[model samples]
Target chain A: MAEIKLNNLTKRWGDFIGVDDQSLHIKDREFLVLLGPSGCGKTTTMRMIAGLEEPTAGEIWIGDRMVNDDLPKDRDVAMVFQNYGLYPHMTIFDNIAYPLKVRGTDKSEIRPRVEKAAEQVELTEFLHRKPKALSGGQRQRVALARAIVRTPKVFLMDEPLSNLDAKLRVTMRAELKHLSRALQITTVYVTHDQIEAMTLADRVAVMKNGIIQQLGTPDDIYNNPANLFVAGFIGSPAMNLINGSVTDGMFVTTGGTRLVPVKSPDREKAILGVRADDMHVHEAGQGDIDVTIYAFENTGESTLLTVQWGKQRVIARGDRHLRKDQDDVVGISLNQDHLYLFDPETEDRIEM
Target chain B: MRDNTLKYLLVLPAVLVVFVTAIWPLIEAARLSFTVGRLNRPGSLDQYLGWENYLWAFFEEPAFWNSVWVTAIYTLLTVGLTTVFALGLALLLAPGGRLRSSAQALLILPFAMSPALIGVSFRFMFNPEFGLFDAFFGIVFPPLADVSWLADPQLALAVVVMADVWGWIPFLTLVLIGGLASVPRDTVEAAQVDGASGWRVFKDVTLPQLAPVLAVVVILKSIFSLKTFDQVFMLTNGGPGTATQTLSHYIYFNGMKYGQIGYSASVAWLMVIPMIFLTYAYAKFVFRKADQ
Candidate 1:
């Protein structure tokens, strides 16, 4: 079993830190996602683990070996790049057979193993064709089959699905999930898309500015976000962070409305993070407060109402059948249990 | 005018320029090749000889066959040696930094100097008594110190090949550097992470992808090497007993020195045949890449 450990790993290009003193222990057979915005060091961390980028300080241990100075080939790792990076001149079968061939696998053994990997990725039928003749999705499958042909110690994927179209992305995401389950290898996946992280990762390490901001499971990170960035980053529509201040154990909007009470004491400035789904949509004056809708959108599955709350606009999700128009006044009420409070200065969650 | 007509009209100037500078001269040369064209006899320009000049150059001339052999071996040696050295230099200078960038900038200096000038300079450096290379080879190898580089038959040919290769490597190396740059970095990295050593990555991934560009380089270098004339003229003047007399030098000797214009034109037309095939091959690569 292979487990990856990065102990105080730091990568700096002059003054700009790529991965700043980061330490992470990924368990054996666990699929850990390094998730962040662009330039947030997620990809850099994965590259260092893959031995593609050298760390300026500290050690990287894969299994029992301190492989800080090992070359990428010597580390026994496989990576899927964003662009698929298939050998354009090679047939699909040859592409899948490259790792085995390079490792000096038996000539007779290469054919059947390549066929098996191709069958797993559903590329067996197209084995004779070169990569140039394949579609984008087929090329991506060739990359997948190549990585899985030889069972390397760890699998590293850098935004492997980012190049596909939206519908193809969904289909490939399911395929990737199935493949990772069957392979059961230690995988380090890097992506900026929170949905992929939430769906595929056993645990996601959310990063910002070269530092790991939070490390937890999907449910833990989604429901109990560690900071304002995580709360704003992990959701589909993104959690609504309303600007306000906490006064006398009560949250007050910037427009001077004394809203729901929070457990934290008074603070000069605070941000209240509330997801759109947490707020219920009721008819005018029937809920906690009546507000006019600034914009109304019907997403087919659910309707969204951007309501004018005092002076600021906060969105509320309604049922698919709930039809409302612009300037339509609707009543809104907060789910008191699901609300979160954060310190504006530190951007950290105010644990209460 | 309609769009189709306007498109052709816009390109008409370039077409006329090509016709005037290239096509017209080719047609005139073909016409001249069929006659007994001589400078002293004014009426001989139109006196029809009908394949006599071609037959003489093909069957009656021993010096013509000698030049052909010299040119064939010359093209082979220069193209092969230049491409190998250029590919090495391109790889060394491809991963550029400030020092390497200045080094790359320095490579352009030799290429900027005229070929005729390079041949003249090389002649001076290989002089037996007090030449730079003569002294250096004397100290380094001892045997070559007393040997006159331009005095022997085989050695003169070797010196000519060296001069041509040295003059051409900078341009080919720059083109190869561009080709190496266009090879996708992702594929190389993918090979590395797929358990390939650096040498294997180059052989398996980088070289295959660079094949088309390499083919283009070889074809371009072959065409240039076949047409080499100025260096041979200035360096040995086809000397050490005509050891370095290429096809162009042979034609110039027959046409300008002996005043046998029709014979030289027939031989020049014979030279044009190989060029046509090479130009066709070069066009195929250019169009194939465009299609992609």
Candidate 2:
């Protein structure tokens, strides 16, 4: 397995910059995901690493060798395209066996390798079937099998799981993570789906525009975001950002709602970031903020209540039976230790 | 009752047209095959000949058999050569860029021109003494300078075939272009990534996808080439000892030109049998295989 490093890579089409100057180092056997919205250059970055696209500037190094001039095959890398570009005319056997046969591997070795790979993907029964005869999930398995059969140095997957149904996607996500670990190959995966990136990545690099906004372990990027963009982009019900000013070293909202700063008192006059699950709701007099519970949704395991503190909406996760349309005075309390402080002007974190 | 009558009335024109134009003529032709009277004569139900005309056309008539052989040779030669040339051009121009539309327009110019114009133009170009064809070929073949292309009984048929190829290859090329263009670009790229070279990609990925379209072009070109009359009429007028006389030309010469209506109708029967077989074979082999 090889570690891949992008040294200030940038891609531009005419005047429009597809990927801004970005640098990242993916460790050996690491499952690194570049996650962003569409047009955020996540796929472009993976393509540059795969040698399918040329970066407008900078170099890509796989292990010790600079691979900017190498073709995809020469770089010892394989890609599972989003469309699962299987040769429609060939059977699944030939599709999975192609790379081996192309490298001029011996005829005797090709059959075993193909069967082994197919068995790993649980596709032994489909070896004789054409791609048109297979379902979407089966086609995905074939693409995965094709990538793994050669045991290349790196695997580049561009939204490979996006085509499968939601249930299949979850199953395939877990399988891909396990397979990456078992094979111990460096993989650079690109997807706009935040959940896939969170579940499959050893480390997630959240991007915006064409620049890397944050690069850290999934927990670090989620719990400790570097900027407003990262804080807003990583979470599902999304992290709540309330506009407030530091008054006497405490963050107070426009409606005079106060929050205990988990950060040091020196970082004053900043925005407060809190996770939706971190806020607790109680009877009006027992909490710091007197908010109204506007709506509640029961997610089977827990109730998610949308509380309005002053003019802003905040979500609270709890086990209380709050009615969906009930308007009741509620008390809100912060988690105390997990609150984040970001500079109001720059939107960057104000760490104490 | 009203709705049923309205539906039947809506379809009445088409049903009546098919019965009058197609099924009626077929039934009449089958009946005429056993008759002893010509088409211009008042046909009588009493004139029962009982398949004598079929026997005479097949075994006794030399010109009818000669026409059959000539038509078969012309169809095979024209369709075979046209298919090869069209496929070659389609391969060259299908994966096109800046020059694609211009090449397509140039290729389609032949199909847009009338076949009679095509034939006349070819005849003037292939004239023995004054034609540019002899001069151009004389530089390469060298022996073509001494040969009279139209007057020679042996080469007159070859000239007709060449004329038909020029007039018809464009349609086949156009059809195959649609086929080749529709071969998925992603599949081609996948083959390349699977380590196939240019020729292998075409043979493995492209040829299989193009088989149905190629079959249609071949069958249609064969049918038209078998009945080709415009080029033969304008170029040689079926001269040089009937060497260039095809089935359609034979029908024209006998029924209209010579007024041997009964004999020509009998010759027409022989031609329809192969056409029926070819159409059925194509539907079975090519289109059925494609659907499967």
**Using DockQ as the measure, which candidate wins?**
1
Off by over 4 Å in 1: none
Tens digits of per-residue lDDT for model 1, A149-222 = 99999999999999999999999999999999999999999999999999999999999999999999999999
Each candidate's TM vs. the true structure?
Answer: 0.98, 0.84
TM-score of the second chain of model 2 compared to its true counterpart? 0.89
Work out candidate 2's RMSD over C-alphas. Answer: 4.0
**Model 1 C-alpha lDDT per residue in residues B1-292, reported as the tens digit of each score:** 8999999999999999999999998888888899999977888878899999999998999999999999999999999999999999998999889887898899988899998998999999999886898789889999887899999989989989999999889989998899899899888898999889999999999999888888999999989988899999999999988899999999999899988888898999999999999999999987887788
Q: Which parts of model 2 are misplaced by more than 4 Å?
A: A5-17, A20-25, A47-75, A208-210, A243-272, A309-312, A320-326, A340-352, B1-12, B36-48, B95-107, B128-174, B180-182, B236-241, B281-292
Which of the numbered candidates is closest to the native, going by highest TM-score? 1
Q: Write model 2 residue lDDT over B49-94, tens digit each, in one string.
A: 8878778877887987788788889888999999999999888888
Model 2 clash pairs are none
